[model samples]
Target: MSTKQKRFIPADGLAGLKQNFTKDALSGFLVFLLAMPLSLGIAKASGFPMIFGLVTAIVGGVVVSFIMGSRLSIKGPAAGLIVIASGSVIAMGDGEIGWHLALGVVVVASLLQILFGVFKLGKLADFFPSAAIHGMLAAIGIIIMTKQLHLVLGINPSELKGKEPLELLGMLPSSIMHENAHLAEIGLACLLIMILMSFVKHEKIKKIPAPLIVLAVAIPLGFALHIKTDGEIAGFALVKIGSISEAFKNGLINVDFSGITTHTGIFIQYVILYSLIGSLESLLTAKAVDGMDPFKRKTDYDKDLIGVGIGNTICGILGGLPMISEVARSSANIGYGARTRWANFFHGLFLLIAVLVGVQFIEMIPNVALAAMLIFVGFRLAHPKQILHTLYIGREQLIVFLVTILITISTDLLMGVGSGILLELIINLVNGASLKNTFKTNITLVEEGENYTLNVKDDLVFSNLLGFKKKFQAIPQGKYITINVSEANIVDHSSIVTMNGLVEEYKDGGGKVLVLGFENHRQLSKDPTSTRILKLS
Candidate 1:
């Protein structure tokens, strides 16, 4: 008789470290190379001293890794949080004072994040529609690109300061015309390298991180172009990493809490943004990394939120940018064969070492090179494919996505996301979803031995998804479960996607799940996860 082969699962905690030390260390080193430049870029973009970025990353990896719920995710400062971080700094003040004030905001927000996990509200991330989240990210991407493009073209920071994203975009042509020749040459060269690296398919070559290659090429080019000389470029052109040792010697308690009293309204606003958005992004990244794990491990979202919150609190106290379970670095860690959380620890250890001992080498890096890297990152976030994919899902989804992006760019992230959610509700009503069931669960469960049947009689939409999930969770595992959405007035894209995930989870736990009632419904689009509404007789 043939038998199914068993899959090996790695041990957790100390055994995991001992068993997978070599693989984890190697992957951690590779991810360190990727994180170094990106951390600096994200920090500078957020209006903080670049060295603080490394500080945040170091804490994310070395500290959060142990406490985090996900085994494979690499925690660190991320490009996704740049917009909010920068906004906090700008809103609080502008320069050194602004940075310290923003740190205060981060501290309060991180405490709230801890409370969120304590309350087990990590699933609240699911409350945001998928299209809206994508749109929010795309909007942040555009903002990043617009702000960094001027730097990439070697425009003086003084001239670019205080200009809005759209206004800066309008000044791009003029900025290019007045660009510093030597700085622009290096920046453009690095930008070209970043763009070309994406098209490289050679297996061995691809294994080398792109950021390392950018640094290799840009450093020499900087020297050759005399970028450091007063004749060729301004003093601000080169990165000012400063002395990590000196900063540590001064003290870690650098945050300014006075902003809470002086800028009460703005302080509360930023606190909400930092905690809400940071938790959402970290949870989503953890979920994505879980899907990518070869061992099929799952993350405890609440624990992960607590870990991230702790890390952010530390970063804020030390005057560093808030951190998250960064998606790109986490994905790269998986690709590099990281088997445990130690990979994250090693990455942070390496960054700590670099800042402490390699300050001179880091100072040689050009600000424009970092700007080039960020611009490329921004381009990926707002890429055309995101729009195309959303449209392929459904026209209504496209509307929500576009509206989210537009509002995010025109106003702020909070308002933009709120608008998207509101618009989706309106669309749901237009499509015949009943108002009475919009925010409440209307499900009944029947038990028959090992078999359970769930009858959903209300609209299955994002607004009521949390309640629906709660009811689903009450069902015992390792049983046959049937979900009858046939009576549901409308089953949205979000609910459908969530249901699909629940089915997979149940099956993984030795239970069988069968979904019924979609046969009489009309799909909003050809995509399998698209929303469905009952067809007219």
Candidate 2:
């Protein structure tokens, strides 16, 4: 393909398919191994049958891959969905009625996502501030870590399947105070896995996926020979998966449209919540995957949303769990050298094969091993270094991240996300630029012999960056402009990157530009100093 054509063309879809066949197959097997335990764990967390997660992973990977625009994303039951799904399932009974009804609600909700994508609403992701997104995700990481810790150590609270963090937290003190031996041993095992993961920092070792190694060791150890505790009870006794027939007896299910005929308002509310969370998660994940693409390729976000909507609808119809573009699985696929969507297909194929043919053998796998894997995953999410970095970036951002984490752990995802967004908006408004200066501070034009000095005052954050650039951009073609930032307190990384690009573009266009008064700017440190650049930092 010509360069122009190549830019627009999708990756060698057919060629990537043929070339990555083996790689995709291998990736599929690996993902299957990782996903199977997760599927059951997430489903159990959501207060649903363990089999539901397997169904979601299998169908989501196979069915969603084709419709998705993102080459690297893997769709499956998301941890983010557990809170909502669990609630919906409970609000709706036992047997097919409650679960199927929730599935019905999901189908209706997914239609909204389709509508969002059709209208190019994925761009709404841009409206969210980067600080807030980070805060939100960081909060989610914290919540997941705290709640899953109990599971990592084999402590099953007699409460509901998926209780919020606050409720769980309230119970945690007692759980720890009374000291459940199973919980203690499991917790210790999880800690060990996390330590092992941290020790693996080499490039080659890092590529091995730490969670996989933890599971490889933990499962065999747990299953082949059970470990005894001080109480003489085996640690593996608390680990549970029940049976495969639990999933197959009711292989597929559908919601009762008839119930919605009576309580449409509540149904509509739940439906909207489902679609909103699914869309936001998918949008964020797509952007994340794009960042990881070696070629800097961008996925069409709207198209991917549509694909997710379609995928969810099918998953609902087939008694599958709600699906989203899971970052963990997607990153794993990329790490495994997957080059095409065929990798996703193969992943799904493997999931199905495992459940169908290997179910008997798979059942023998101990939950402690899976729990060990998740404990490592949780550690990565709630890394203390990342939290420290957030604090260093901005106290407001740190607060937002902390609040999100607390609320997520203490309450639920919706409340946590809502709290983060609210905090983010407050931070933005408080730090927002002065409207008067933002609007009126523009250079009319460069006059003859004018040594155009653009004096930037105070902090030059992104909110006022466009105005800063506009003044320079409007300089007369034949005149000179010296951009001064000596008085400036700070410069955002985005603005700095923009400044670098502008400098090159303006110079190439035969315009003389001078950047002065910036010596030790942290933003500048990330970029190289070009020959034409005079200012440093």
Candidate 3:
């Protein structure tokens, strides 16, 4: 994008502000309305107090929106980052220090992200295959689905905290079987509202954020039905906002940083995981948002990375949750007819205004309503058919997808991604040398008394040296190996080093090895005085 195109703030101040104010304000308000329930839920999932989620949402809307270069992206505590933040909090304090240290960690992580952007490392996303990305996301959806089932039923699944996710999945039905009436009613209400909103077809209805509608209904129903009748429902009972003051008060949290270095490995682990996941999620959201731009604005990924990094750094410092480019809010902004980044700023202002104004009445909303919204989000993410469709693309791609999904769900994100990359490298290596244009490449397997020739034409470099090493290693227990690089244009130092290593390995294996090329080639060795073909007898 050119300078004029990338410019978000119009040169004309007052006039530009006026031209955008109303439309941006409406878009911002709509996004804020959509974000409220989600922000709170994801915060809770992240092991933070409900109020922390709101603070992050507010900061993301107000602070990050102002600085972010990407138009129409909504920033908040994403479900994706909950794993990192939760792990960070657990490792940092476990009730020892304040929340300040956690803030410091966020700042450090964000700085790393900003540096990644500065260095133009956004292209790293291309290294991972598309199938793996899909599989990773699919696994996340499954995790969310399993976790939220308890929320949907109005029971504290965390009560069974030590239980495995699969075990908890089996335990949900029995909990519902002996459920409290209030819990059952709230659960059913959330599910019903979610279903209706998700499946119902109407132009107007589709535009309205379903979660807001659920809240509007659930709050009034809670008051009318007095779901809290006869005191606590169980050993633990439902909590209603007693007053705006209390709701705000319960949200204040502390962070601790002293032990962070003591747990330096854990800290780095969280930072790396958060940076990787946050980048992928944000990039995907940015791409989708760009597709929706009416003026066809394309986002600069590097610029977005820096913007989000700044947002997250500030969020960590201020006790707000880590922020990312959220698709939920981004799509909502687009659907609401937002034209520019101003829409994001206005949305933040709307959230601030809503909290200030709605405080007195905000306590009336029910948890089940928010749970319903999450259930909806989870369903949208867990597209089971996607797996089958991906499989149709290729058998190898299917294996990659399945392996990634299973590993991610069973182990962790990093392991799954690493496994996928390793699998891809192995597959590519097995396919043998394929050359295009004037380049000629050949690999021949030899056994018994047969002779094998590995040929190459055109530029030969360090990477291709690995192939040579593999071919040399394949020499039979009592067979000779020959490498023909006579037609090569060039060989890097690394390639020569590799050949020397191979020659030693081959001789140690009691196999004969020969290299036929370097005798007449210039720049073939580190020392100009040597011109003999590197050979092992």
Best of the candidates, lDDT? 1
- Write the residue-wise lDDT of candidate 2 on 480-533 in tens digits: 668776655554433554577566556645587788777634332323321011
lDDT of 3 by residue, 481-517 (tens): 6777776555433345446655655565567778777
Q: After superposition, how far is residue 369 of candidate 3 from its true place, in Å?
A: 1.9
Task: Give per-residue lDDT, candidate 3, residue 26.
Answer: 84
Question: If scored against the real structure, what TM-score would every candidate get?
Answer: 0.98, 0.74, 0.74
Residue pairs with clashing backbones, model 3? 28-347, 98-254, 98-255, 98-256, 99-254, 99-255, 100-255, 101-256, 101-257
In order of listing, the candidates' clash counts read: 0, 5, 9
Candidates' C-alpha lDDT: 0.90, 0.65, 0.65
| lDDT, candidate 2, at 268 | 74
Q: Which stretches of candidate 1 lie above 4 Å from their native place?
A: 1-5
The window of 10 residues in a row where model 3 has the poorest summed lDDT is 528-537
Say which prediction, candidate 1 or candidate 2, comes out ahead on lDDT: 1
lDDT, candidate 1, residue 291? 82
Report the number of backbone clashes for model 3.
9
Better of 1 and 2 by TM-score: 1
